[model samples]
Target: MRNTETIPAELSTLAACQEELVSITQCAEAGISKHAVLRLVRAGAWVRITRGVYDTNPVPVRDRICADYHDHVRRRAAWIGLLAYPDGAATGGCALALLGVGGLPSELAPEVSRPTWMDAGVRPGTVLRRYGTFPVVQRHGRDVAELVHALAQGLLTLPRDHAVAAICDALREDRICLADLGRIRSLIRGRRGVVAVRAWLELVPGRDASPSETFTRLSLIDHGVPPDGQQIVFRLGGTFLGRVDFAWILPDGRYVVLEVDGREFHSGNGMLADDATRQNGLVGTDRVIVLRFPAPRDSADGDIGGQVAERLHPLGWVPGGSIGPVVHLD
Candidate 1:
């Protein structure tokens, strides 16, 4: 009874809508009868995600188990909030999702803010806030809070590791830079979590390419073994030795390379072989010791900080020197 592959001709108008979400009013306008919508819903062809909203995507069940599916769910929630309050703009995690920023928690609550409201009704899973004035920008054709504003909003609420990971994601994606850090601070000024967010900001070098790398770096810092640099490129004579996720220069001028392997970026046979070759090249350089930390299934998988510390201590890396800089992109 499921018809995910084809859209009925009677629902052409709904299919033409910009997003998967379509209102009942819009369906009526498109010449689709209420009976037809009801029948489709009964047939599992259309899903009702909200009171009067339908998700026309009809995605397969198997496809709903991956990270991409989770991201789609986040976007769907944002759309629901946006559709419910047309004048409201997506902010916080909703804006981050729409902007394609990663390193977000698995659970995302849709948030929207508007200057005013009429008959305030209940939005099932969305959070509504009132704001006098704020900067708004369009992302994915929907109104969203500006990048730094959204980051500030998200930072105020996300967990410590998640906040830092989001900042790292923003920097890695070139969505923000060290210069924007001040603006982000200004937005969160006088807020409850400003102190913690500021401390985390100082800890971020904005050079780690993945959330796993950020987490790995944070673990090291917590154990008083922060790396001197991140995303450091090395060269042996005229050949490139490849870039390391993190590196520390010992007193004797040797280097400790920390590589964080996240499944998202490092998968399949090709990536594995490339990683092996890169590791071989780095070791052949004869002045570096490489440490690889793979993605963990649970919090108890391994001690990233302890492992790195074990390698670093033997090389005369003291308890602390200085962490990497949050480089200005400009």
Candidate 2:
């Protein structure tokens, strides 16, 4: 038999307690018996996520194939932090997604940090991490990994491109600050993932708004003509003019703007007009040169940012620094 409609009256008193998730031990502490848990399961009020972990918000049986269902299951990993590993918390790529910065296109198996002895034994969808310092505190009412901790953890798990993307994405989204990156740099001084992440972050611009944007920025740097600024905003005295994706200031003081069409953000009629208005104001009064780069179809098409940099060469923008080249997929 399975849970059907509502929570049983005996267990109803613990409503507030089960908001995040619950465990058998937690239920016992709340004066709820195993029988009550089983009844709630039968009433369709809770869904068992792992061996002892139960999600209070059950995904309906018929809707399991939907996208939202997948997102729901991934979020259940947070409960492990709140219940099983009270001191530990979500980390790695999982925490990155929670913070709204990890630029992964698809869902990944949720990862958490816990002591070796915790022994969640055979939880299929969950990955238990035993390395690096954890025990992150809550950020938005949910137990979340600290930015540096999350970045370090993420850098270890993700490919270099994706790791850089996540860092830029988080910074651009305001999910993390540059000062915090410095703090992470110090905190993870001797950690395993520190060296690689640190080296990469040195060249990454926080002005990138998304993973693709991060890739674009890296492409420019790798091609040897990095822009002076990204997400550049223009203001005339007191009034706000507009902002562009990338900007370079020529030796003669003329400003050049480059906008990459990543296909991630598309404007409707209203937003399109607003953007046109802003761009027009800048172009008409400031005489700024604006260039747009549409995304490359595949790796063979070469880097869009590199292509943009070559165009800027004739306009008096010069490349800076002789860093090693980025691993361009193209």
Candidate 3:
């Protein structure tokens, strides 16, 4: 290990802002030679992230194997792009992730963007987009597109459900209000995927608790069997039964409670017991029919939609009555 006393203040401060990462130019400016930097890498005190950038606190093996490994790597990749292209700002999903916006896809590439003239040829680990004069703000110690711009750019590439989920996450997290959606749409007005992105943006009511809930809700809506309510609390004589993921109001005044079971929050003994208790309490009301389905992994998982349609059909839900034909949000 290198001596803390020998650590240069310039390198320390620079690394502190860039996720403990610093470039070779920064090291040189701090009076460290290339030879000493190589020795630090060889001695396992630092890790070379790209050609010139190095991570002072190398990620541990335990963290590499943990559940959050992907998220950790995504953040590092964002920093890598920012450090590699100092003038480029993190954009699209990378910017959204850095801004603490949730509901992004599990896999996302590090993206950096600058003006069209500054085209840097073919970086391997990061995707570069060419743009001109978009808004920028400092986020996570790196420059990124402003929230509205980032949302528009992200929606252009994400799948319909994912785009809707991202908007839901942004609204729920208070990153943007319903009013800002108009500005986001304004930005995407003449873009390639504007039609679909506009429709997807309308799906974000922002009440769903997780990405799984967002997926399930979209699936049901796509099949023309949208839930009447979501996160609806059931109670009998003021004793709280539970807040359900989605709910349907039958014509006869009975309720259909649909629970989207996601592995993240549904696993383990404690959660299982809590789920059992909640279901029992809801059933005791005698006005609720509970349906549990594993959260849909993709658009093709239509079992939840089909089953909800089948159950509702017997209880006075006409296929084309107030709800129109399947919207088919692909």
Q: Candidate 2: deviation at residue 320, Å?
A: 3.4
Per-residue CA lDDT of model 1 for 1-330, tens digit only, reads 676344446556544333477767667777667777777788888877676667776675336665577677777777788876767899888888888888777667768988775455856777875545678888645689887888888888777777778878898888888888888878888877577677766866656778777778778877778878888777766577677788887887667888878878889999889889989988886777888989742222468888878878887887455434322111
Question: Alpha-carbon error at 186 in model 3, in Å?
Answer: 0.3
- Cα misplacement distance, residue 81 of candidate 2 (Å): 6.3
lDDT of 2 by residue, 1-330 (tens): 355544445444443443346777767776767788878777777877676667676765344565444334445444544454545567877777666564543455557776454674546566777664565657445567876788877777766666777777777777678887776567557767666667876855556665666766777776776777777667675577776777777766667777766655634777667767877877776547777666433222357666776678887776552211111111
Model 1 Cα shift for residue 42 (angstroms): 3.1
Q: What CA RMSD would you report for each candidate?
A: 4.9, 7.5, 5.7
Q: How many clashing pairs per prediction, in order?
A: 0, 8, 0
What TM-score would you give candidate 3 relative to the actual structure?
A: 0.80
Model 3: how far residue 152 lies from native, Å: 1.1
Candidate order by lDDT, highest to lowest? Answer: 3, 1, 2
Give the TM-scores of the predictions, in the order they appear.
0.80, 0.63, 0.80
CA lDDT of each candidate? 0.74, 0.63, 0.75
Candidate 1: 10-residue stretch with minimal lDDT: 321-330
Candidate 1 is scored at a TM of 0.80
Lowest summed lDDT window (length 10), candidate 2: 321-330
In candidate 2 the C-alpha lDDT for residue 131 amounts to 67
